[model samples]
Target: MTVENTLELEHLEHPDHDVVVAGGGPVGLMLACELRLGGARVAVLERRTDIDPTLKAGGINQTTAEALYRRGLLPRAAEAQERRLAEYREALAALGGGRLTVPPKFAGHFAGIPLSAELLDAADPAFDGAGPAGEVGAVLQQDVERILGERAEELGVDVRRGVELTGFDAGADAVEAYTSAGRLRTGWLVGCDGGRSLVRKHAGFAFPGTDPEITGRQAVAEMTGTEGLRYGWNRTEHGTYAFGPMPGRFLTVEFDGPPADREAPVTREELEESLRRVSGADVRIQAVHSATRFTDNARQADRYRAGRVLLAGDAAHVHSPFGGQGLNLGIGDAMNLGWKLAAVVRGEAPDALLDTYTAERHPLGAWVLRWTRAQIALMRTDPHAGALREIVAELMETVTATTFLVKKISGVWHRYDLPGPGHPLTGRSAPDLALADGTRLADHLHGGRGLLLDLAGDAAVTDPARGYAARVDTRTVPAASPEETAALLVRPDGVVAWATDEPADAKGLEEALSTWFGAAA
Candidate 1:
């Protein structure tokens, strides 16, 4: 069934918006777009009037790539990927690549160690029936934000720029948010406002985790006498440093604890000193273009929701920028929460559906923290850490180890624990299947509604969704393997809610529909 474009048709006592998002970054904008697609009224309150042009998160993992693909924005993502690759090539050409060594097949890195693309198993089960989104895409953070922000505008999301969310009071019915612009009423509030989230703080969520033990600095500058630095990531005796993946981009990690003042300006002298300390190359900085400071200070909210308030992205969890998992993880959170929240607001599903957000995402968030912490362990400047790093590096050269690590780094191996599974595909991401109509399964899901695919080609298989015609769409898909899966019930976020290898069972299908899409008509 097709959804209407109408908005804000709730009762008279309904709040001004269904949801008020506290940040207008990529994750926030993505969530707003998802909410709008699910037919919810959403408003994004952003503090910055202009997009920050800082160089951060130069690529997205496979999971995030798939999310964009399912949303019909794959072409834009492809353009962004091509642009990033062209820029990388141009930068390398300017560097005059003669003696400088770089990895031949760079897929990704783990704690500065290169994970080769050649080592990945092409026949991995994770790639079975996967589409173009199974691969990673190189796109900057600002580029991702720009893409999502434009999509949000087109979707009719009310984005208020230069207006910060100061505080809010969450009541039983709705949340009254006090913003820099003024007070507003929203049924729910989500904190996507980065690490220093006022919504998370005002909601009194317990944020507990490890403190910073390293100060990391990244800069793009014009410099002279920098031939001594390595082309890619390098572990030095003092700290770690990487150069030239992008023209003058330089990064240094020092184990001298966190910075004294995180908000302090990054000067050319400071960057030059860091390069010397890590590379011992005596390089001189000619001009600084863009620079930023970071730390490995990791923390996670004890719970993601409090009453009518919730958190996502950096507001929900934060860690070191070691593997570039922050943005991908946040995108995953938005994709997971957006549909459920919208359903609850529309009174289609009970509020209990929202509880599953914490149950499913908290474990993944904890795992990311552990993943980054392990990298920190391998990055320390101690002799023991050096020995461990050497052993790990040797192991990483093997195909088995590289394949395992790449899967983790690419974010393609995640599987949720949904209730009452029927097939192995249950609770996993639904693969993009080639439909009989020459379209793909992802094409049917662009509207942000649940999907019931009748692989058995039986009319009875589509009957369970009759009660939920508005919330779930039914399709007759040409099953690639009827022996493996005869029917599939997919959530709006692309997660498989239920699957059946045997013939389609109406009882099981109805249970899944009621579980995820509320009581049947």
Candidate 2:
């Protein structure tokens, strides 16, 4: 059924979208774009009337940074970074110096602990500093939403704002979902609707986990009598409160239990009260800016997939935003789910292939849950926890100790234990193999097809790929170095599904392709 451009009519004549995504936030927008890339007709139903420009997520993390780059959106993101960097440099130069000392680059932080550039560099080996200067650091959540929303529209995703998922009735093969505006019919309904996901609840996916012990708030607001309040992460006897680099932006975490009313809109006045509570400061508020609240209310759906309804991003799991991992984690889900669901929707793959989405991503989500929990444990207000925090801080100060945090936070620490493990690169991000013509591996993924980096120069690999030529992008670039690699089959998500340093393994190659891109018939 063809969905029309008109968003609001009495009903949708074409309710048969390949997928109906609930939520217009970053994750949902990204998933919509990915589904579109996979040749699946999608209608993104967002309840929000407008795209939020709130700096809700501070920046994009490593894997997401790579995912955006693979999709050819990195230049735009780099523009944001470059714009900020230039402004920062200019601001510094105006302060008068013989040679303007370069400002300290924002080298990312874990929990509230900052990691050094050296630690960050050693965390992800794949980052060769070729694309987008800096250590694959921050990109505003607002920028991500804008880029993804535009891409989704360009790919013909029927995005309907002010439409929300009220409930879903799952069928054997399709889903009938009720929304605030009307009902939507689709082969699949993915809830990227965020932590308070109605789809997850209505679908009866067991979402069992711990609730919030501490409430966290971050805001860009004005204040008065701010003297003596240092601008940085300040761990006080009461709890943790900090001032952002910019004077207006402030962050505070209080262990006064979760807010009395979670739905209560965070305000600048409330922010000052919390600041005074945590920092014991005589800070006064002069003006108001955007403010928000969060908590370490970590929870994960027992099952991410249930019948025709599936969940991703915050719908699948929720954790503390300590490491800035929520956006990155959600994008990771979008990246992993896009092509698989696309293949299923196109009838190129079996339904069983969709099962891998849960199998692969569930453990990763569980790990992130524990990661947040551990950080929370270390951030206790008591002396015992303070001692532990001190130990952890000392560890973070050391390059070797900090690498662990950097790797996990950067997404280099986890590798999918995919079938047919030949080399370490298998189930990892495909190496940025530079071709003699200066083409990089990520360049081939702009079309959202599977890629086989045939560095072995073996003609045998091309034969298997021919059967799935439409889905698999097979490229045999001359190996830049002898010991670089032999051959690799990369998934659309930039994951190396199969790799071999020897002559092409026809049987193994076929298995990988058939399992991923579907049977070679």
Candidate 3:
């Protein structure tokens, strides 16, 4: 049974939309934006009518931040999140430690371990290694939902809140959905509903992965004896305790294992006891405002698409909140799947193109799961792991080691193994290098179309781009990089489909265009 307040839907049975997305959270909303951008009719069915106001946790990694910027939603996204992470870190460092110092952040953290700017700079040597290769920002999850929802609406996506998908019947061509809002049919249905996804379960998708072994909790409360309860992550023999950027906001990880009752409420007395046990301090809780429990339970769907029904976000994968990658991962899923799915829906690409979604994202999802698993293992209270953690912490201070991890955590290193001649830039996020005239390479992708960026102003690149004139946008800009980057063929999702460091080769470029964008229009 669904927990949302149910309402009677008007349509009993009918093909109402090209796509019907189940779950209107940030992931679903972002997909709606992408679909709308592709001129596809999309609808989002959300279970919640109102946004959750609780300040549980907030932030997005640099990778997702770039996606928002590419779509011109960065202004709105910036308004939603305050990138005051440095302030938050400063507060924590002030708690008690050596002169804990760090460079300006370019990447996010893993288990409270910071990835520095110097590391990213050494690897790319561009962007001055200051932040994620592109934009890097953070906002509360609720604000993320709000901004994406507004963007979806702006793109004309139909969103119906307070309606939940109970089940769906999938066929070779379409999906027949049964929801609290009645019956509806769409050419495609994506389950962004969440971890305990009704669609995934009903569709018989195998969700096989590790289960939760530890329980993490966050609470906001009125408390006394705030002494020694300063900001920063602290480890105890029992577990981990962290106090905050704001007063009375606290978090603890208890190694007693996952809660027997995952649904049980966190009471004030229990919160106080946990604080005392984890911190080994006599902290007293006076009143509790709100609290939630989570675990490191990692899981992923064996397949992303099951016939006409699909899955994204928590429905497709779930992991511990160690690095703040869960939401970012889901948003990335939406961004990657949106354009490809829309192209298939609009008959601009063949059905086989849809299969690549799993081919690209499932490995990324698996990596996230392993990444969180490593965090869990490192953050444990066990003595052996504690020693290993100290070694890693020390190693993170080095240039090469730190740079490697910075790219990993920032997700800038994610490169799909696409069909290419192994050009270093292939299958990577197209560099947002600026031309002599001051236009950036990323700007050309704002329209969500393929781009053949000619850094050399080469005639060779423009000719093939003309073959697929309707699908690819060709732009000749001044050579923007110190290295040889003659031209880059970029997919709408901003991944490099092909690249040439010397000069554009017509045959190579044409093959890339046809492989990704289809036969020249």
How far out, in Å, is residue 170 in model 2?
A: 1.2
lDDT values, one for every candidate? 0.87, 0.80, 0.79
Highest lDDT: give the candidate number: 1
| lDDT for each residue of candidate 2 in 177-255, tens digit (9 for 90 to 100) | 7877668779999999999998888889998999899999888766766665875677888888767654466888888
| TM-scores, all models, native as reference | 0.95, 0.93, 0.90
Error of 2 at 455 (Å): 1.3
Alpha carbon deviation, residue 100, candidate 3 (Å): 13
RMSD of 3: 3.8
Considering only N, C-alpha and C atoms within 3 Å, which residue pairs clash in candidate 3?
A: 81-139, 92-231, 92-232
Residue pairs of candidate 1 with colliding backbone atoms = none
C-alpha positional error of residue 62 in candidate 2 after TM-score superposition, expressed in Å: 1.4
Give me the runs in candidate 2 sitting further than 4 Å from their true place: 1-13, 86-103, 118-135, 504-507
> Candidates sorted by TM-score, descending order?
1, 2, 3
Q: Which lDDT tens digits does candidate 1 get at residues 391-473?
A: 99999999889888888888778999888755688888898887667788888888999999887887667877889988999
In TM-score terms, candidate 3 sits at: 0.90
